[model samples]
Target: MWRDLLPIGRHRGSGGYRRFAWTAADTDCRAWFKAQAEARGLSFELDRNGNQWAWLGDPLAGDAVVTGSHLDSVPDGGAFDGPLGVVSSFAALDELRRRGAEFARPLAITNFGDEEGARFGLACVGSRLAAGQLTVDKAHELRDADGVSLPEAMERAGQDPGTIGPDPERLARIGAFVELHVEQGRALDLSGDPVGIASAIWPHGRWRFDFHGEANHAGTTSLEDRRDPMLSYAATVLAARQQARLAGALATFGKIAVEPNGVNAIPSLVRGWLDSRAADQGTLDTVIAGIEAAAHEHADRDGIDLSITRESFTPVVEFQHALRDELAKLLGGAIPVLGTGAGHDAGILSASAPTAMLFVRNPTGISHSPAEYAAEDDCVAGVVALADVLEGLACR
Candidate 1:
């Protein structure tokens, strides 16, 4: 069951999963999913935004039960980061079938595309587009690092970009959404537990800063004669750290690119992205405002032109407590609810729909890398917890 959900060597022995959506690895994963759904007698349907759904009952239901997660991962993300929830749901459903439990509600397992933003610059692209947060035009305009526009990529993948847009009729069918994911951090482990109910997700967003300066020969220009944009970008990076530290928030300067990058030439321009988050929008605003101020200051000092553009911002998300309570009781009432500093597709759905999450323990606190993990026992426990949660949610 797990193997079908998670193909080993998603990164081909890089000790990490590498299923960026629409890429080779991700497409393979999708094909496996189609096979699994067909075997289970579920009908496969692709939505306007490339989100795939496997319906277990009447496809036209206005309020069906929804359970699943993304299948994409960071460049070298661990196995459980994305696929665990998607797999566990299928496994749980299989177990449910064995018991022949009487059921009346329709169910579906979905695989949302570009959830990690590992390829495209925006995260949760599929869900955002479906929920009307991202427009079809802008989505078509997005490109990967290799300069492949999202529309072109979709066309290449046998999908029509013109048909991608808000999917209210499709989304309204989901009565509630439950995503089972490996605990990206060590929260459950710290509590000495294998599972948890999500309380909330911190607000998070991404922004890009572009700095322009005159490119010149490294050997011909003295230190005082150069208006290097790299200097301003460097200063901005340091300031981002300082501001996040001062505001008690999370911030990162993870991706950057420099024009005329060479050993003997001063860079003419540097463009980079900043990822920032906090528990509240006010705090997040302060964190970003401080970084922007610092960037302006650094640009002035270095005599460089600077521009900062907002990419995407997700507000803080609070999971459905009624469902969370139900999950806790199903898991023996000893379950805990924890908030995450990271953004998630579950969080995005919780904005307009009733949504909750089950988090499996990770012994190591690390995630978004190859070192993330969940022991075998923890994995089994997570499946049990998911089964319990789904049984309860579907029954209601």
Candidate 2:
């Protein structure tokens, strides 16, 4: 399955992928998903919120067990982050079919839309809409780098923007939601294990900082005559790093935009996004507040304007303890229970479903970048573990 998906969005230079949501690569992935489901004699549907679902049994069956992950990738992201769980889902099903395992309840493999928020600026957009956390109008208004709205993007993906909203009936059908994904950090590597059960996810959020100033010719503008917002932005970046370091939290300015971005021109406006996460909400909030105050001070000093807008925020998510314990027991008590700093579709789904996640070991202990890696053996182990959990939950 991994080999088959290699060419869809593979980057030649870095060998990483750029499968942003609703792009050609993402469309190809959806087509591939449909073909895979058709070959397996399973029915498939694209939900109103743009999530793709492939069912092993009656779609109307009560309390279905669902497993799968998103296909979207961060810019230059490695092979495993989102696709691992998707490939594992199919592999696990193949194993079950090989053994002729019969399920009493419905089993579904889903590929959620926009879990990364790489293009839309809103993570978990698809799941959040399905769970009724985000209104349709607001989702449609989200814009990308080129100023294309979400509605426009959805139309390009062959989905109706008007249909993009809460899917209560569909959401209600999920009795249990289990997403098996490659671990984004070093927990499993530290334990020298192939797999682990997720215990919790740290509180995380994204905020946008916009600095306003006057644009001018870079070579002609005198230093004293210019109000450069870029300077304020730079200072804010440093402040974010220092504050996060002092608070023992995580803060990153991974995405940025400069208006009229040109080497010969001074930018009139600078916009950047800050992704912050911490073990607790208090620490996370404190670190962000400190960074914001610093940005304000820099803006004041530079004679520029600064504004901060929160894009998204997810509080610390503790997986249902009983379910975590149940999975641990089902896995023979050998696997470790671990907490993660990464946010996931599972974290969003937790608000509406009994959500749990199984994490496969990542050898490199890195993610959201080309350096992330998980061994083939570990991936196969993940499939088996996921299949075991499905059998216990979905099969009679």
Candidate 3:
């Protein structure tokens, strides 16, 4: 699966991938998904919200036992983050076919769009819209860094921008949704296990902080006379680290932009985004509030204007225990239950369906970057694990 996808969206310089949603590369990936499904004699259907579903039997016959994940990647992100779940879905189907397994209920593999929010600044755009969490009007208004509106992007992809919205009928068709993904962290490595069941997702959010200052010639601006917003941003970054450590949460100012970004000119504005997560909402809120307060203080003292906005927030997601237990029982009694710090479409879909996840071990304990990796053997284990769970759910 990885080899087949290596050529698509390959970043030659960094050896990572840039499969941002709605782009030509992403479109190629969707085509690949359709081809793979059709080769196996499956019927493919694309929902109103742009999510693709490949069915092994009649989709409308019964509530479907759905599996699969997104294909989009963060800029220069690792190979396994989104695509792992997708290929694993196909691999599981291959395993079932090899065994000649028969199914009673409908089974479908899905590819969700824009799960990373890397392009449009809203994670789970496809799932959120399908689940009725985000309205079409608001979604159409979203803009990317290049100032391309969501509606325009949809139009570029041959979709009606006006038709993007919650699909209650489609959402109702999912009996249970399962996703198999590479472990984004080292919990599995620490436990000496190759696979595990996801128990919950930590609450997480993104905040944008924009600081205003004067742009001046670097040679002409004196240290004492300069009101540089970058200083406040730097201070906020440090405060984020400290507050997260103190509160036992995770906070990172990973994305930033500086206006008038020439080396010879002082930046006029600094826009930085904070990504934070915690075991509970209270700790997450406290850590964020602390960082915000410290940033405000720094901005005031430095004579810099500051503004902050909550771009998105997802509360802690606890998977339905019955589904989790059922999957564990199917996989085997000894499969470990785990919780993840990273967010996923499965986490978003949990609100609308009985959702669970299977995670393959990642020796690198890293994600969202090129260094993330999973051994081939572990990936195959994930495929078999998923097939077992699906058979238990749909093949009775």
Task: Give the best candidate by lDDT.
Answer: 3
Q: Per-residue lDDT for 49-165 in model 2, tens only?
A: 899999988888769999999998988888888889988998899988887888989999999999999898899999999988899878978999889999899998889888888
- Per-candidate TM-score against the hidden true structure: 0.96, 0.98, 0.98
lDDT of 1 by residue, 1-396 (tens): 675556643666677887776777777778877887898999999898988899888989656778888888988887777788888878878877776755578889988888999888899999999999898888878989889999888888878888988888888888888898888788788899988889999989999999999999999999999999998998989999998999989899999888888999999989999999898989999999999999999899999999999999898888888877877888899888899887777887776688889898999888988888888888788877777677776654
* CA lDDT of every candidate: 0.85, 0.91, 0.92
> Per-residue lDDT tens digits of candidate 3, residues 267-355?
89999999999999999989999999999999999999999999999999999999999998997789889988899999999888889
Task: Look at candidate 2 and give me any clashing residue pairs.
Answer: none
lDDT of 2: 0.91
Candidate number with the higher lDDT (1 or 3): 3
- Which number leads on TM-score? 3
Q: What is the lDDT of residue 279 in candidate 3?
A: 94
Per-candidate clash tally: 0, 0, 0
Q: Which ten residues in a row have the lowest lDDT in candidate 3?
A: 1-10
